[model samples]
Target: MPVNVYRNESLVQMETYEAEPARVDELVEQVRAKWSLLREHGYAGDYPIEVLRGNRNGGNIKVVEVFRWKSVQDRINAQTDPDYVALAGQISSLTTAEGTKETYTQAVRGFNHNFPSVGGVELLKGVCSCLLTIDGVVKDYQMSVKNGIVLMHRSPRMDLDGDGRNEMYLKILMHGGEIIQAALGPIRVEQNFNRPNDGIVKSNSAGGSDFPGTAIWRVSWKIHTPMGPVLTDPDQPLIFGPATVNHYPPVGTHFHSPTGPVALVHEETGARVGTLTPGELTAFDIVVTKDDEIYADVLNTPPADIFEVMEEWRNRMGDQEVQPVVAGATDGVM
Candidate 1:
């Protein structure tokens, strides 16, 4: 058995199965029945199975079944067991052809943060997003964050499609608060094609601006199914930073704690950027926010860094000195 571990935790093994559209339902039933038998035969740990319908292609429906086991040894033993063998044989008979299986281990960081608690059902509750392009039109669908949970899997870098380059899986929260997972590739088109002429052109001349232009690579999101790139929904908005008022300036952004908002400010000028809402912010924004607050406060003045402003507010609130009143005559005398 091949087992891979990261930082002392054994990676969870995932097995994916694809089958013809007509036989997917039947195959799922068969797998569940086999699972029941495996439990009776002393399969004690929690094992989750998901059935997803891939976009239809060439009259074939792609069905994906994912299985997450506690350990690679457990997976190997279960597959080689007599009962499992019989079940596999029965499942193969119903498929149009032999389904493919791939094994994957979960990253320790991703697993610990996402599925920290018991129960496999928690995996489906995390926020997810789906980006799809159909007929040359691209759109993004965001799933709402529920119970403060985000991402079924932390951005695990892996070669999910067996391509030479690695891809990152992003879980987007859908409009109905459901999960729609998508894969993002990091490699640029020019690099992937290996053609120097195909790459993006760079300019070295300074354009007299404080912020110089730099090349940034962006990846298009694709639906995580065997079916060849089908659009899921076109109406949903792309998942970005905190939701802000439509007319709000995009200069500054805010950070949030359990108590309330923490305004992000400029490092040198200490000018307020924008305010963040009550949810998770983007990775890029988080980095910027941390970088801005690394310096100490000069004085308790206007345009101070957010932390300094907060500290000043707390100090004023704690100081409670009574003001002296002028002496006055008794009753109506002034």
Candidate 2:
């Protein structure tokens, strides 16, 4: 058996058959044999090909076969091969022609693989827009990310489609508490928002120099980190240092931590950039070529020079002083 890994050519095909009641057992065996043949000829991926059986209307048998093609050329090669063609003819004969269906789709990252933990972060390695397309069909879906934060968590393993196999789940937490969940199967694709392109990246925040009071907005900024959820003081607004413009050299901005202990986390992926203990100042640098958000959590109580706790909330709640981000900067890409 080949080592389980995602195929580079992520094309997957799903075939559904409504078999005649009399030929249910034979059809299921034939489907398994077909997958075995495909794997023998290097036409199938290393992952397991699923042969799911169910009861259809009128006591007929519903058989669904899902498999990944090793490459686009391998899929085309199977269409005309003599042995494959003969098996396909046998399968067609077993199933009702009118009830047969097939679909082709591409898998993104986080499909057919399990994460080590329940919740972490996975940044978009490349650009993938909100609009998803499969086999020339444009899906009506949109997942936009503001401030480059994408929360991800895993759902409990269960048989979502009654396919007889418990599927691993990857759930993406979106803005406004909306969640996009996908099964770790061939057709399921994870939505990643990692592009800084002009058309895709949008800014919905608007402000002006109107005659508004300075302390209009004072809600505490809640930042989710690897340690846990850190909430800043509502009375004292989170202070942001001046942005360092990177135009000439085109390098990411350098960031330094406060004079006390804290933890630095990437806002997009939730990956820990670095940690700082007492008397440690340097944490990590912002490495994005475009605008992004990073947060710092004060691990312990520090001197007033670095960060101080609120009087009212501190007295009642005790020491829960988590400092806001030390660096929230934007850099230009050449």
Candidate 3:
């Protein structure tokens, strides 16, 4: 089976403006609305877009906005897009041209930033659930992660193919920014995109193993490691600062779960994973080992239990919604 490599180049843009003392708040809100318009018009970037306001020497406010361009073409398109142009006009009317500046920069790779440590041991946590099937027998799995690695295994080892032992196992390591290794049973594949050799580092860690039939895996997970938080939902991009809601499609064409059920059947054994009812949608990442072992990290939450989960939360919180207040001495002001 052939593998797919997805890559996209993005540019970070920084803009600064000076605003009159009285119009500072108004200018900031206008700039924010402008960014929202650009996002609504599909001109926003992949990473988080920031708008910061600070006090200048003369009491005039300095506003700085930082964001990434999805691509060079998107940057070009935004300049001509009517929605963006109109909003840009509104923003320019509120700023002083003397202090305005804009610059674009690209990231330099092969460098690691120092991340804060806790108790001298950096911990990575990933929480997810999976619907796993072995020999037509299905079971639900709630997976756990440790030290930036996800491990899955079957308990009470049973011989599904009469192999005299249990053989279901999987390990996913995401210590760095990208997926570096994935193992299914005896087969494994590894790669390091940061290195010059971007191809597979080791296609097979163990001796090749026979293909497993009709493996049904519905896994939804969020991995928080030293590199960053990894999300399966393509709609939610990773951000270093505050994130805005994005309902648009992901950066590129990656396979994702649909609104309805999805069923996969094996050609040879005629075995199939059961169909799911329509419910919440999640991202699907399918990795196939060099030995033809397949792992589909697609998670689908059933519709029937959605309300039950919500009700449980309501009960636990005494049917009250949690609200935030000022840190201290604010008399309940937010």
Candidate 4:
């Protein structure tokens, strides 16, 4: 029957019924009497501690405190009485002093902040530059503000180097911890990405609505297919960007394809030459030649089909090689 109560919810009280300690029961009584004192004068935090139990034990009083916002530890420490020791010896005569322990477990909870808008631009720029341009992490990721505009770029950190950091993001918050916005982009990259990428550049057409450049610059895009160093077909697409030769994202150009997803390089020296797997052939097995000079794809390619239809773009360098890189097995159909 001895219990402290709080009506706001279930209850956060020091339960003694489950314990065995006569001295503690008495301490409970003395604690109740003391709490009654704090309650009468109204201490602080506008919250009052309610004493629901009062009994004799170990020559002391057993008690518990009830309140809102005030923590359980506060109540336990509040147990201060000069009379406890003398009273404890007296209570032990009636019942043997047993054992009890103070056990505690704390909890933590939280949520995410809204995406930043204005200052976020600069924040995102910094994040991308630090992660990508600075060369920290090895993985690459794209960064852009989403009021619905592609505004930033952050390449993977690890892909750029042998270093072991990931291109990550950080949220900017006020002194009070209220998050104001986000800073996102690549960081810690070992290599500089100078590949021709214009889809990510924002701009209008050369003759269309001019934004800021003397000529039309660029805009972001989602390339529908994969790209290669070259396509056998003269009709294949090239990098889609402002053409010193022409302007616009034409369908059959390298620029017209998606941004670099995979990397290609010389097999021996580990030098990157912008070679890539033709889209749809990611699973083909690879074998490095004994000379350590070139990577010989282990997977087999399709049999020569002089009679079978050949895609002009793929046959050259677009995707499918006219001769099989692997033997007679056609894998990763696209």
Ranking of predictions according to TM-score:
3, 2, 1, 4
List residue ranges in candidate 2 displaced over 4 A: 1-10, 98-101, 108-334
> Which residue pairs collide, candidate 2?
none
**TM-score quality measure for candidate 2:** 0.33
What's model 3's lDDT at 138? Answer: 27
Per-residue C-alpha lDDT of model 4 across residues 1-334, encoded as one tens digit per residue: 1111211331233333222354555555654554454344332123445555454554444444454324444444344433444443343443333423233343221211211111111111111110011012222222211212112221111111112211111111100001111222211111112221211212223333222211111211111111212111111222211211111111111222222233433333444433222211110111110121232222111122210211222233443222212212322111
TM-score of each candidate structure, all chains considered together: 0.30, 0.33, 0.36, 0.16
lDDT of 3 by residue, 146-202 (tens): 122222221111232343322222222232212211211221111122211100001
**Greater-TM-score candidate between 3 and 4:** 3
CA lDDT, every model vs. true structure: 0.32, 0.38, 0.36, 0.24
What are the per-residue Cα lDDT tens digits for candidate 2 across 136-231? 122222322233333323223333334343322323333111223131111222222231100000011123211111100011123343234332
Top candidate on lDDT is: 2
Best by TM-score: 3
Give me the runs in candidate 3 sitting further than 4 Å from their true place.
1-10, 98-101, 109-116, 119-334
lDDT of predicted model 1: 0.32
Which is the better candidate, 2 or 4, if ranked by lDDT?
2
TM-score of candidate 1 versus the correct structure, residues matched by position: 0.30
